[model samples]
Target chain A: MTLEIQNASARAGGREIVHNLDLALAAGEIVAVVGPNGAGKSTLLKLACGLMPLHGGEIRFDGSKIGSLSAGELSRRRALLPQECPMRARFTALELVLMGTAISGQGRPMAERVAIAQDTLDRVGLSSFMERDIMTLSGGERQRVHLARVLAQLEAAARNGAPGCLLLDEPLSAQDMARQRLILQIAKMHAAHGGSVLLVLHDLNWAAACADRIVVMHQGRIQSHGLPRDILTSELLHDVFGIPDGCIHQHCSTGRPFVVPHDLVMPEDINKRETPCILQ
Target chain B: MRAMRVHAGWILLSLLPLLILVMLVAVEVGASGAGIGTLLHAPDVATRNLAWMVIAHIRAPRVVLAAMAGAALGAAGATMQGLFRNPLADPGLIGVSSGAALAASCVIVLGVDMAQSGFLNGWAVPLAGMLGSFLVTLLLYVFATRAGITSVTTVLLAGVAFGAFSGALTGILIFRANDTALRDLTFWTLGSFSGANWERIGLLSPFLVLAGVIATRLAVPLNAMLLGEADAALMGYPVERTKRLAMLGVAASVGPVVAFVGAIGFVGVVVPHLVRLVTGPDHRLVLPGSALLGAILLTAADTIARLVAAPAELPVGIITAALGTPVFVWLLSRIHGADIPS
Candidate 1:
């Protein structure tokens, strides 16, 4: 029950973004794609979700080309949270979550969908804020609303025991420290519950801890792919991220390989600019 | 709830006086400002013939035509606001009305006499205007949006560009016109319910009703759309299709009204907003309320237009602006710097 990408390529305005990338994620597994800025992390997620047309190769979910799926079918299988979706409406947390299923064309009665959305909000620890407007919420709370929406899609998909795929593009990037770890734990719980996840995260330490496999990307190409401990090595980090050796240390707590940078370096030092960090 | 009932009561009480005044003024202006109604009902050959000519051929059709045109413009404005997800989106503000005006002016100046059977005259200009509006709006939508999603900023910027261009072209056409052509074009641009007739009323009615119904059907999707395209698309909506449909619906509704009325402004922009303030932003309630409020507001304005000049009869558009501008300023001043959502 794994999703596979075979030599998949995508280009925007004739400029290649994701180049000949191949990936496979087993059901109930979490894969994190870490890359330097302009390494096309978001583009890869866009390609996977069929938001952008693939220039070459294929993406298959359960051995079928994802391109052939109807928009509704594709949405039912996987949900994508774009890097910056600024919704204008001042809906409650529950309504925002309901919109996720709405994309899949749930077309259920408003009351039932509202109930499901409220339940999802409660599960995501936003029960008390069910009636509060999303615009009034903090960035962390909004991210949780986003997560709850995606998780709601999965929970609804659980009837046939088919785990939904959550494709999050830098879900925790805009979030603070405490919310970041909380989101990672929630993602881990989704995977543990037999759901699939493919995340684009800059924080390698969090990915190393939570992800089942780590795929390192450099210049739109895969640099390494393996378990976190095997792939997130000092030499690979220096080569891909331009981090000097021994600067970022891997610390294990709760039996996860967590890494952190001991030194401060501007992301521009890597010479790629589009990748966003929470600091600014 | 009591407030709504009061608003409704005010509308109803005000509506009766408006209807009577519209009927009286339309009769007085269309013919000589005389006691034509009493004279026509006088049971004499010339009197009865004149009454039939004035009432059947003129005033009744004009009042109904004004009502239909007003309703259509108001509804279209509501739809455009829903389309932009911006409360300030008025049909006239974006130049859909100007595009329609230009088409209508051309038809009038060129004198495309479609009244061969005498039954289709009122409809001919409106049809031309709707076609022109459809063309211009379609072009704007195509040029503004590169992909499936339309960036709001891009749409607005493009609208301003197109609107200015269309207005310039309309000015050029008017400038080049002869005396009679200029006079005809002037009233059309200033907005008139003066050219009201059975044919015009009939032509606008179906389009208005259909556009209103289609907009209501889209209310749920439109509300979801304000959350953003990605969010709307995820919510089982055909986001791109919905946007296109709503834009087309706005043009379809607004185009004919503008063609006939000559750029009636403000009602579309103001009525929905006022409704939103009372009912919150739910389109389900907003669409219907905007339509009703628009009809009532326009009828009142036209009645005032007749009363203000009494004998001369200034255009309804003038009255609407005179009354609505202060309200617009008040609404604007009331906003305590809420962040403008992009």
Candidate 2:
């Protein structure tokens, strides 16, 4: 499936949050979106997933306009994981995950849907937590359960012969380091299975390590989009993210550029130093 | 540690016998001294006939009506809670009971002589109550929904405002009411199954059935909705349609029950929580389990109401609130640190 966003502009509370943004995701590809806070990263993801309406332009999934497809039809082709899901009801982990398959598993048997939910939970290393109440789980654990839910949605869609897209926003924010790697690995596996993943991420190093291409955003517009090696430069970081020039370095083994903000001037020291400071 | 939750199907299956037992107990324990033994083995045929008449016509209908109203409230409560994604959301949260009460008060104070007007005798108040509830629901939808999407927060706040407005109107009608009208309004507000009969049951059945079907179909979508609206939509459930169906279901079911039996509280708010404690949060279980458990609780409460004052019956609503408060507080204490959102 090819998910395309063509010159899309999204507004929130009558003000434009995403302006004339253009991007696309093909099957078997993983694209990571990196941007500073308030850069419209989450809004862009919401627009792509049809959760937010575009002020102008349009979004299409598999050559069909998003507005043309019914919600059920669109969901069969894509799933979204928001930044945070605040659940007030006490649902078991398996029950919450099973909800993900509700739409795509309409004609499928109950056993198959349950199996898919279980499989996704197991993939996220939550096999033992299937019956645990989500309220009792820690924040990171709850986040993984939701991640499993998102994966289960796509897994059911794939089983129906329509491998779809995943639009995740800050999926790793609540996770620990190992689980973060585990989540990115799961995304990679989804891409390997001919599904596409477009995830908004804050950690530049992980973005560089996992993404096939990196898209940078600043002030609701795409600043740059290219291979990780070409995109992760000190000049781009200094311009867009206000990082110091020496912070971007190529990893010795993978040759991927990783950011080391350690020796950089802190915000308070920016005016005292000769380093160009673009942050205002 | 969490208590072991019974499987939803088993809980549903087990509730059938329990409900029957509660209904039988409710039927047997009333103000009348006639028991099952009196119906079967009275000393004379005349006495047996009297026993049978009282049991079948009076106790049976009242018990069955109580069960029906309880089941409607329970299922509606579950649906409302699921739709709002708030554990505290009650069926009455959407102004159904208040609106119905306002309309019923209007009918009573106006002294509509429907018996002479060729209308269905004694049907005006209930029909007006139903209309009032539907109108409030419609107004809420118009005010809270923009385009196709309904904001849950807006719906919640607007429902409270509408409920207060209706309550104020009802108070005005109460002020203008005569002695008889005031007494009738008082009984209606406190709620009772004293008016239950075959005809009232027939009138309430269709609305309850319609609401039940809608609530049953909403189980999966409601489960998806616990993840929140955007996520529910992404999961392929029609979020907007689900919200509309839920509001309609609650209004259709709860309206008639309040119209027929006055305004019973606590059953709608507490029964679902009780069901969730035993069956977890899956609506497939919570909905049906709620219907059964609610029937049992309300039937038992009505029996208590009947027996408490012997010949003079207490309104069942008083019993529900009196009994429901302790149980609800105990439940809160039990799940306090674990489940309640901060």
Candidate 3:
């Protein structure tokens, strides 16, 4: 396993947000975590990235206990893109991306690291936006700039013979349709190159389209984990998400399950109906 | 503007000479009418001695102290803004100046005997100011941070409270002061460079050196921190250490300057903003650039303070506030919704 968390529990704000969770990602695999709000999906991502301390159990990266690794060591092994970056400084996109290589690409020639930053920006379709101030860019464009930053970090780590894992939280939330596919392709490319990807996604259809396996979370616990086809069922939707049946369908070309989400079920209606599952 | 980003290194290079030029002008122009030429080539030995006395003993130390104090406040302001993640954060606004002022006031009122003694004369007030600022910064940090996350709003709001609290204490001290102490107190509150001397320079250098070193080391970490604390840590920086060092640097640097110069305002806030307008927000450029620009601005302002009212000078603080307030108001109006969190 490239990354593993065994019976890990994490606390935030004096409460256990993630309780007794065990998850692992093998090398070259893409796993998607889907859950309702406050289900601890983001907390799990933070735990996996070592940003949040685990209250119990252990996490290991490449068979080494995560606690044993220094911050520099851990960074070379993995990179994280948060749900929203509260950046208001007037750094140019290129300058922001170069910050990724600042630590990971230590001792590398400055020109080469700048080249990597440039290439990553180009990959995110932001080649021309590099000189632009990050604050001036649209929300989606700024998100892509940060995506390029983490990608640059991983690329720099790859030069040192470490295939870095990418932990992303709702990376597609700010992206448009085309850029959403672009980010998925980028994740797939990272996985194809012997790295692992663990992403928290809210759009079940996009998660099904990109993730090799899907994990559903409910109230800080893993409800189920399996292939997309097996996990993205109407029963799971109706039980966990309070969505009615018949909203999920298979895509014709890819055979992946896509959620239409057309039938709006109000909270009052959900309360009036017979409760299918107990929500904690 | 894009060209400025690419050539930020060049801008830093250019600021050095610009600072030297401003320093030279500051050293040349004064109400005493003593120029460098007079010191170098006077008509007689007695005239040259008089010029030497005015320039060497009076103007040089004052100008040097102004520059050093400006550099400290400028760099500390930039570091505070970056650490707090708020562009509007200033040493004056965040209670560092007022905290130091309060300590200095205590030394003036309660420790008058110690201030009169030869051994603890110069060391007492500055040391007390340093301790005061350090305590306030630590308290603010502890109060604003929970679960390793700092709230910018709490930092700013608490700073206002601290400033008010210290101001009231200083006022109480002012009420109990004697005639000699009252003059010193007024100077401390309004800020002046009239007390600048070689001894004060010797006393202030170590603190400035400590601050300069911390500012340079914090550049990259502060850059990463602009993305927020968690993201900075994931990118391999020790975010907690960065925050600690920044606070310590600000306290150490700003405390001595406020004690020595009497709480000069706006140099800390205005200098960094001016530098950012020219070079963008990269702290690598911002820190050193603020230092240089701050030195230039304070030196120039002191010169104007000396000249505008002739022999009787206005306090440098008044001049900085006059120049800085309009720019600050304009900045507030121009700020985008995205720049500050609601």
Give the candidate number with the greatest DockQ. Answer: 2
lDDT of 1 by residue, A223-242 (tens): 77999888877788788888
Which run of 10 residues does model 1 chain B get worst, by summed lDDT? B1-10
DockQ for each numbered candidate: 0.24, 0.52, 0.48
Better of 1 and 3 by lDDT: 3
| Residue B174 miss distance in model 3 (angstroms) | 1.3
Best by lDDT: 2
| Top-TM-score structure, candidate number | 2
lDDT at residue A207 of model 1 (Cα atoms): 87
- How well docked is model 1, in DockQ terms? 0.24
Evaluated at residue B210, the lDDT of candidate 1 is: 74
Q: Tens digits of per-residue lDDT for model 3 on A1-280?
A: 2999999997778888778898889999999999999899998988888888889989999898999998888888889999988787878899889998888778889999999999999999999998888878999999999999998988887873646889999999998999999999999998988899999999998999999999999999999999999999999999999998888888877999988775676877877887574321
Q: Candidate 3, which CAPRI tier? A: acceptable
On residues B81-180, what C-alpha lDDT tens digit does candidate 1 reach at each position? 7777776777754557767877877776665455223765556666667777777777777776775666656767778878888888878877777887
Candidate 2 residue-wise lDDT at A160: 37
Q: What ranking emerges by TM-score with the best candidate at the front?
A: 2, 3, 1
Clash pairs for candidate 3:
none
Compare candidates 2 and 3 on lDDT and give the better one: 2
Q: List where candidate 1 sits over 4 angstroms from the true fold.
A: A103-109, A154-158, A247-255, A263-280, B1-64, B86-88, B92-95, B112-124, B141-159, B340-342
Per-model lDDT: 0.72, 0.87, 0.85
